[model samples]
Target: MAKHLIVGGAGFIGGNLARELVGRGSKPRIFTRASSSLVNLVDILGSLDIVYGDFLDDVALRRAVKGIDTVFHLISTTFPGTQMESSVYDIFSNLLPTIRLVEICLASGVKKIVYASSGGTIYGEPKTIPITEEHPLRPKSAYGQSKLTIENYLNFYARSTELDINVLRISNPFGFGQKLLGTQGIIAVAMGCAYYNRVLKIYGQGETVRDYLYISDVVDALIRASERSGSSIVNISSGFGHSVMEVVEAVEKISGKMIQKEFVPARHGDVKVNILSNKLAKEIYDWTTKVDFQEGLRMTWEYLINKRT
Candidate 1:
């Protein structure tokens, strides 16, 4: 019960996390799907102990948690927009595995579990400018609903069992390892479309605002949560808001080229504005973003540009 395991350590956040931990002289174990690509982990792949398995496979899940203390659960098989495609995919794929994971962790004598929750979709429409952790839990989309459900389960397990848990309601994170053309991750998608000379689509005149945090800061928070002594729920965010139009302008400024835009009607279940308050995270964990917005954008832009070469 003294080892660290990253359940979904193949993706953008997870890969970066593994690298950071390795740099800090910690040899972390990574649990990812057999199908997940290792592009983001190419540099640090040799430094990790990777175990491949499906989330629903009890045997595999149990094996992953065997002799491990803190589990960083970061797996999401479905995106926010595509969660509605299947009636039960979110429940079966995302939510159920979490509950089962807790059961397995308890059985294996694992100490703590740090879950990656969503800040963008969890609190649907904010009644205030900067939403706090105390805001009512009302998610508008299937993805958000699924995250909240997992949070509830974690709370129940924390209270009923000896297992410790921490839920990180992370804001929209954009950086080097994110999906370049994915449906989610506005900054990643925009950068991808811009590099490939594809038209960037704007929903509802680019009015939606979201809290965007850098990936390094996000990894820092995840590491902090793993070492945190208390079982609690906190928001990991930049505590600032950025609109779609503002993002577009920033990209244009960085790339020095105007991105071709096509404005479309707003999609369903989209939040109008979301700005998370990181005051709790600061107070609780003494965490804050060291990378500013413009610097983060510049780094992302450089990564995207170098990607084409």
Candidate 2:
């Protein structure tokens, strides 16, 4: 069993990935900020080791990566919606820290670094359906640009050094424990509004198509990336598209509640269609999204209901 370190382990995907790794008895150490909430990892907290630190703190990060065989990089400071925010902040908050992380990983002799990237934002408007890994990266948002920038650095590291790097361009992920009413994850937000009788905000015609991957499937891909030795960049997605309107309807049907909608102008950087192909992941990582769309939504809804009661 290789020693594993999970950076930003308090976020949605990070939390789920931590749960899975702990269950596997790898006893992976979680590296999160001092203020990060541990609610997501509540059930398994006692069985795992947790390290609190800032992403830019050299000493804390160095301590976290020491003696770790595989480091899972899951930190991201900005969302695609924050494209209007300063690109400098995006670069400093995400890109710069990642560059520093690579240097530290190399110096510490870490075996591999699995980076979770955005599949939704990286490939702007798709010329083809089910966008493949080879699809051109034309990001419309600074958020996507920063992620692509990190990928470029990792590619450069791969060419110049012996560091093993696996970049998993993950599609829009949503499931249990996901934050509701946030700017991201329409599925979770819609369900929450339906249950709470709050208005669910819709941008543009609400027909934008996006590939949504359930949380468990995402954890599987990350685990597969860490278990494998060789380095490869792959797209992790459900290979299916879901419109924003489709998510509202799914929530209505499953939760038996109508979501009041408040249509708003679409943001500038929003893309009309962005679905990803997982063929490369299947071929290399031997992984596929096992959760059905409706089933996954149902499970998420049940979790919310159970939480409130």
Candidate 3:
């Protein structure tokens, strides 16, 4: 049984990855902050080992990396509804911890490390549609900037130390186990609001396009990336674009309920259209997204409804 260490394993994506590992009969350890919500991880609480430690704490990180063969670095502090001016807070809280974690992983002799990068924000306002990995990274927000900074560090580590590192530039991943408050998953938030009879709000004209891949597809990409060699950086996306309004309409159709939507001015750093091309991912990892958008929406809505009862 391979031992894997997942940082920020309590969060939505991390938690789903951990569960996938467990289902595959591997030993997975979850490293989370002391105050992180456990709602997403409650079902697997008994099967996994939970270690509470701040990312900035070197000693704690050292302990977390011990005896782990693969390290999945998925922790980040930036979220929606956070004040943009407090970018410094996110850097100090997230970037520093990642640096320390890399140091620990190198010292501990970990075989491989996989990083979850932001495909949406990292490229900022894309000069080219269907952005590829080579697109110039011109991040408009501090969150995007921070993600890019970490990706640079990972590239340096791979080149300088010749370490086995893979960076998955993941697009918007939405599905089960998503939190209602975060801007990470628009579909999840919309479904939550619909379930609770709250009005859904759209920024701009709701024509903004994004590549929304389901959580299961993301997990498949990560697993394949972990085992594959060469091409350290690749995009994990659905290669299909959907408008914000389309997502809202899909959610309403799935839930069999009318969702009230309110539109407002676009927020700062919001990209008009951000969709990634998965050709490289398909060629390199031999993987392609199988979940159709409607199917994923149905699955996510079902999961949310089951969890509520």
Best by TM-score: 2
lDDT values, one for every candidate: 0.89, 0.90, 0.86
lDDT by residue (tens digit), candidate 1, 162-198:
8889999999998988887777888888887777778
List the candidates' TM-scores in order: 0.97, 0.98, 0.95
Error at 44, model 3, angstroms = 2.6
Pick by lDDT: which candidate is best?
A: 2
RMSD of 2: 1.0
lDDT of 3 by residue, 1-309 (tens): 557898989988898998898889876899999999888777778888888898888888888889988888888877643467878898799777787788889999887899999988899888887899899999877788888888888888888884689999999999988877556578998897789888888999899899999999999888888787643899999988999999988888999998888899888878889999999999899999999888999999888888779
Listed per model in order, the count of residue pairs whose N, CA or C atoms clash below 3 Å is 0, 0, 0
Report per-prediction Cα RMSD to one decimal.
1.3, 1.0, 1.5
lDDT of 1 at 227: 86
What is the alpha-carbon lDDT of model 1 when measured against the actual structure?
0.89
**Better candidate number, 1 or 2, judged by lDDT:** 2
Please list the residue runs of candidate 1 whose C-alpha ends up more than 4 Å from where it truly belongs after superposition. 83-87
